[model samples]
Target: MSLGKGNFQFFGGSKTLYELKQNMATIGQQLQKTEGELSQKAIDPTASMEDIQAAQKSRDDLKMRFDLIKEQHDQMEAEQKAKFAAKDNIQNIADPNEQVMKAKAELIKATIRQQPIPADVKQILGDRNNTGGEKLLPTTMSDQLLMEPLVKNPLRDISTFTNLMNLEVPKIAFQLDDDDFIADTETAKEMEVTGDVVKFGRNKFKVFAPVSETVLRGTNVNLVQSVERALESGLAAKEKKVAFTKSPKSDEEHMSFYQTGSTAIKVVEGANIYEAIVNALADLHEDYRENARIVMNYADYTKVVSFLNNGNSTYFAAPPETVWGKTVKFIDAATDPIVGDFSYSHFNYDLDVLFERDKNVRTGIEDFVLTAYVDHQIKLKSAFRIAKVIDTP
Candidate 1:
């Protein structure tokens, strides 16, 4: 018997391709064995009639099984071709409106190819023209196909600067201590004892995605994709901006490394940036100085490019990849030429990202709501290790 209603609709029928292939393989092996035996009997000059007859009978039985299996396999393939042809025919409609209707129906039926549009959403589809349903359908072809792809966040992979740790609870606890291990001397008193220098604290932050029912159900696929894009982009840009431009206003967040007084490398008026960057490397410790990278906004990066173009060619060899033997990252939040080992920074979160769907929670919302959120914070291990070359304003 077949499985569920439309489990194998895409495969043409409910019969699994695995089972069909296995059956064919078993039949093929039996046929090969029988053929091998028949060949052996014919090659032997002293073979008796009984042996030859038995070999012939085995070959006949195997041939029947092989033929039956081959026929079934061919039939399944034909059915698949027919099913696909029918699907294509449905898609090949001449009229644009008819094509859209067919596509919507296929989208509704083909759950694997489509994100789940809940029952509440389906109900709203008919009533999309009602009040508060202005953006009822997706505007683009590609957006109608699937969910939006995630925005790429380069900081997520950094090991030194950002710790991308998963948290099960609301806060991440850690111990801060400036005390170092003492070298005991025979003449030293009490092994250089000191007071308790350890401090305990937790990092906490709340990220919220307040999605409306109109966005979830009333709008089309393109709007849904846009909403997803906005959520991810906003999270990435805001967190990085807060880390690089704004200091932590409360205990719930970590302080920005840019705010560290000792981390700044002031540039003289009309001073060459290339020389300024070289000097800024000294601000970071020698251990991390080798891995130091330059961060600037696209505008600043372009200005540097123009400066290099007007000067010596070998001075700024690569255009976008490297500048003065160091890798350059163009971040929107970066206002100055910041040099640091960003890998030392950390971003903590829950494996279950803050985004979730809630149908009954929203009293005013009439449709299903999908809220994408993030619970995360950026931590600076050693603020002094990051140096920013600021222009005199």
Candidate 2:
């Protein structure tokens, strides 16, 4: 009833596989022992008919159990082999970008379906397990989403990002010295350069987008891309509000340029928006003016365009992309024009976005909550100058 013992190998080397192999071996041994007992009973004339029938039944049951165990072991081995083969094929792709794209697509599919991401896909994307059932976007996808706002989020484009991953206490260090070099003799005393560090405060931002369960479960819809775009728009709007309109109190951490208490230069009497911007730029320190970017509302930019194109000319020309060789960033939510070196504005963010689903069983409506950690500060308040246009009474 038992097959001969042969060499056996299993993929993945998992504990479950090892235990299955042991169970198979133990069942095979029991079947062999039962067969031997049944044969002896059949040959012995002293053995009763009832005893012989019981031995045969015992042998048949053992054989059935062994067959079931063998079937399970074979199935597990085949699954592991197929997984490894697919991984090998992915690794053998010539183009690295193609490999990443393929892996990213797999991750996206898994995320949309609310299934666990494959182990190989996680390895390729350097992703961690979703222990809390919150799906984490792949690193590549997170980076793409973060940068996507740059098209409409001028603040994000101009601000500098500091990687704070694995940091217990994130901080930004800034040099306080005005001059690092001085004209001195070889034996002149060396001056000490000073600097300061600002500890980052924890700030969390969440964006929620309502998605239909049908869309999430459907194969025809591109749920990942759609959710990504929706989240991107939502985040962009929140960023504009945070960076331009939020006025933090003294006890609160300053997260917006408007809250930094930087020097505000009021527009001179009878000056146009363009002149006001120029005046604001002039007010900034010479050291910061070189890298200064002009940030204003889109409506204000239209006014500047009108001012520039007011005169009748032979050729129709659009406003230059830059003002006085400085890049101009137009945001819709800005109330005042700002001229400053935005590099001094520091932002820190988590490398991955956590996605969670909120389902309403009563209404059959589902929404996804996308969460990310972020902190922002203006390292040097003096590096910025705001143009405050006072109303004429």
TM-score to true structure, per model: 0.42, 0.62
Clashes of each: 14, 0
Q: Over the stretch 77-169, how does candidate 2's per-residue lDDT look in tens digits? A: 899999888766656667876666666556655554567777766777767645735577666657766654533566877887654563333
lDDT of 1 by residue, 1-393 (tens): 233336434333445656777777876888898899889999999999899998898788667655755666788888889988866664455776555544443333322223553433334233232453232332222222112326645555442221223433211133236333222221122223321121223343333334454544443454345454654565566457556665545552443545534333233222655555666666555545677677667776666677877865653456665665777776777655666566545444322222223333556432222222233332223322333344567
Q: Which ten residues in a row have the lowest lDDT in candidate 2?
A: 185-194
What does each candidate score in C-alpha RMSD? Answer: 21.3, 10.0
Cα deviation in Å at residue 384, candidate 1?
5.4
Give the RMSD in angstroms, all C-alphas superposed, for model 1: 21.3
Score candidate 1 by TM-score against the native. Answer: 0.42
Global lDDT of each candidate: 0.48, 0.65
Q: Which stretches of candidate 1 lie over 4 Å from their true place?
A: 1-149, 157-227, 260-270, 311-317, 351-393
Candidate 2 global lDDT: 0.65
lDDT of 2 at 385: 71
Candidate 2's TM-score reads 0.62
